[model samples]
Structures are given as C-alpha cells and as structure tokens.
Target: MSTPQPQTHQQAAPAPNWQSAPGTSYTSPIPVTRTHLGHALTSEWTKIKSVRSTMWTLGVFLLLVVGIGLLVAAQTNDNDYADVPYTIPAFFGLILGQICLITLGVLVVSSEYGTGMIRTTFTASPQRHRVLTAKLLIFFVVAFVVSALAIGFVGLVTSGMHGGASDNEWGGTVLKGALYVSLLGVLALAVGSMLRHSAGAITAMLGLVLVPAILPAFLMMSESLRTVGDKMMDYNAPNALAKIFEIDSENGGGTSQLVLLIGVTAAAIAGAYVLLERRDV
Candidate 1:
C-alpha cells in the first residue's frame, strides 16, 4: 500500500498433448505395425500347433492309419490283394482315423469359444473374417499334408507287401482319399464355427458323417426311398472314401462324391462367414 505493489502474474500450465510424446516429437513409445492376413495366419498356425488336443488327435490319427494299414497288409498274402488295390487297406484305418480329424477340427474353433478365448481373439484383431480365414487356411494345409503323408506311407508299405498286386493306377486313389478327408476336416471346422460349442459341433459332424450311412440300412422297407437311401449311403463319407480306394459304390463314379462334398463344404463355409459377421464374440 505504501509503495504500489508490483504487479503479480501467474503463468498458466501448458495444455496436455497426449497425441505426442513428452518433451519430444515422437508420437508413442510403441512401434505401430500394420496388420494383414499373413499376421493372422501366423497366429492361427501358432495356436493350432501349440494346443495339446491337436497333438493328441493327430497322433491317434497316425496310429490308426499306419497301424491298421500295416496289420491288414501283413495278414493278407500278396495273392489276397489280386483284386484289391494296394491302398485299399488304408481305407479301414482312415475310416476310423477320420473321427480324429473331425474332433480336431471341432476343437480348433469350438475350444476357443468354450474357454472364452474367442473374445480375446476378436478384441486383438477386430477383423473376425480375417481370423477365420487364417484358421481355415492353416488348418486345411496342415490336415491335408499330414493326411497325404500318412496315406502315402500306408500305400507304399502295402505296395511293398503286395509287390505283384500293386497297381500303379492306385496313386490317384490315394491322393483322392487324402483330399476327401481333408475336406471333411474343413467341413467340421465350418460346423464348429456355426455351433460355437465343442460337444454340439462334434456331435453334429459325427451325425453328418455317419448317420446318412446308417439310415439307408433302415430305409429298406420303402422301395421308392430305398433307391434314394442307397444313393445317400453311396455318397456318404466312408463309402466315398472307399470308392476313392477303388472299392465300388452303387453310384458310378466320376467325381460325383467329390463334387457333392465340395458343394456342401462351400455352403457351410459361406454360412459360417455370414453368422460370424452377425454374431458377437
């Protein structure tokens, strides 16, 4: 008061700048990398390979395919295979082995849902379709390759065992069986995605693969339906695989079963995509 107090002023605090780094031009401490389908593929590959179920199921598949194939080959003399292709024995084992593939396929997707990991997956990627595509690609490739190798091994062993009866033409049949089984696995995956429950999807797929074959036997009462039933059995998974092994089915073969399988798988996959898009994780 005595001497006019010096004017006092307080500087305002600097406004926060969250968009940029503190005291620097950098935006963030973490490096940002664009994600693509390849990244998703790698993630799927890691998940499928890392799971215990995958190992167990695939192990059982190999044992069934190779063990039964070798046992059948050993029990039968070379002369016994005179009318049978060297790869026909593989069908017996593969028929059982297909269950393993189906189980694995269902687990591939359904397990995530069951354990609530699917939420994390979607949260991390946000692009659900890409994740599904990656799973499909990696699973199909692995299933196909492993199936092919197992079938080829059985074929080679049986061929050696029945050297005189082995048909060079059997190569195509072996390849066809591998493709068919791989397709079945893919179909199971699609079903799993649609169901989002392990037991439910597995049960549905088991019925899909097996019930058609069994129902035809009970449909013998109706002559009119018998023909249709026969077609169902003939086109069923086991019979189709048998046909590929050069075992004859009532339906004359010109890739009709293959075409049917491809069609069904395509439809299921389309449905899976549509459902995935509309559903919440």
Candidate 2:
C-alpha cells in the first residue's frame, strides 16, 4: 500500500511567467514603440482629421475662395486687362484664407499646450526634434493640400470667365501664392510654439501683417513718415512677399524686401525653436 501511494504522487507543471501568483495583481507596461517622424506624422494626421475645426476651416476657405472668385469673374466688364493672370481675381479671397490657415496652424500647436496634450505627445515621442519635425511635416502636407484646393478651385472657376476652361495659367504666380500661403502656415506653427498662447500669438501676427498695411490709412500727417511707410509697404517687409503673387509684377523685383522678409521669417522660426527647447512645456 505504501509503495502504491508513492507511485501515485507526481510533480505538477510550472506556471507561465505571464500568470500572477495567487492573491497577487498582474500589471504590464504599455507596449510603446519608439517612433520616427513618419509615425508622428500619421499620429498628427489622425488628430487633425478627428477634430471638426480642421474640416470647417478648410470648408470655409474653399467656399469663400471659389464663391468670391466666381462672383468677381462674372461681374467683370471687358475693361479688365487681358494681361491679368487667369486666376488674378482669386487674390481677393487669398488674404482672408491665409489668415484662417495661419490661425488654424497656430492652434495645432498652441491648442495642444492649452489643452495639456503636448505633455503627452512629448512623453510618447521623447525626441524633441523628431516631434517638432513631425509636426512640421504634418502641417506642411495639410497646407499644401489646402492651398492646392484653393488655387485649383479658383483657377477652374475663373477659367470660365477668362476665355473658357483652358486658359488658366497655373504658372509662377499661382505657385508663388501657394508657397507664400504655406510659408505663413509654417510661420504660424513656429510662432504658436514660441508664444504658447493663442490670443497673444494671433495678435502679434496680425500686427506684423496688418498694422503695417493700415499704417497709411490711420496716420496721414507726417510726410516723411508717410514716404517711409509707402516705401515700407511697397517693398520692404512681409507685404513684399505678396508681390510674388502679383502676376503684373516682374518677379518680386524688390530684392531688399524679399531679403528682409526672408530674414524675419528665419529669425522668427529660430527664436521660436530656441524658446521651445529651453522653456518648460
């Protein structure tokens, strides 16, 4: 009987490492992967598409650009110059569309901070430059697509008025306009990153782009200052960048203006990056 009892006993198999001990809890770290910019871009794309503001903003831009262009084209008399670029009237809505694009781009970064999601993003990405570059990539893609849509729509709508559907130029002027608008979008992201406040950044951007534009309208007294302001408006600041879109202009010939505007854009971006790198998010 003792021999039989000894023979009946057998060893049990080991429990899996995944299994918890009796009366103990089991926890696992989230399977996080270290991602490069492409992943970050994909993530950002998801976030952008998930938000309603993006869709609404683009929708409004499309409507205003195409709608105003059609209206202007239809209302035109024969006196309009034949030298005018096929999509010239589209410029009427461009300034407005760009303003919206800049605001939206700024919010893409600033709003994340405002909502405390930036911390989560940084934590997930861990690489600062990667994060910034990813954001830049995502923003550029969106801007390019939106710009193309706006220009294409305006060209198509205005084409009908300019000599049927085939007359659209789609040349240097349209390309320059798209580039200028896209750069503004990038500039917005940079500004927002540095400022970290929407109202302040938007206000500053408006001042940078708008105040100089309206200076003549508001300050009509000083002749010397007026002369200077006229020069400033004509070809010495960001407004000169607009000249690139002017079909009538010979090629944004104001070298000083282009140089100064470019320098400012570079400085703004660099300043923003420095601040972002140094400051606490």
Best by lDDT: 1
Q: Point to the candidate with the largest TM-score.
A: 1
Q: Per-residue lDDT of 1-281 in model 1, one digit per residue for the tens?
A: 59888998999999986775567675578999999999999999999999899999999999999899889888888776777678777889999999999999889999999999999999999999999999889999999898888888988888887787644467776678888999899999999999999999999999999898899988877988888897887788888987788777345442789889999999999999999999888
Clashes of 1: 0
Per-residue C-alpha lDDT of model 2 across residues 1-281, encoded as one tens digit per residue: 45554457567888768866899985558775666678888888888888887888778777776777677778875346354555666676776777777887788888888999999998987776677777777887888777777776776666655564343345655666666667677778888888898888888777777777777654556765877666656752345544654543644533445555556667877887778778887
RMSD of each: 3.8, 7.2
Error of 2 at 18 (Å): 17
Displacement of the residue 103 alpha carbon in candidate 2, Å: 0.8
All candidates: TM-score? 0.89, 0.79
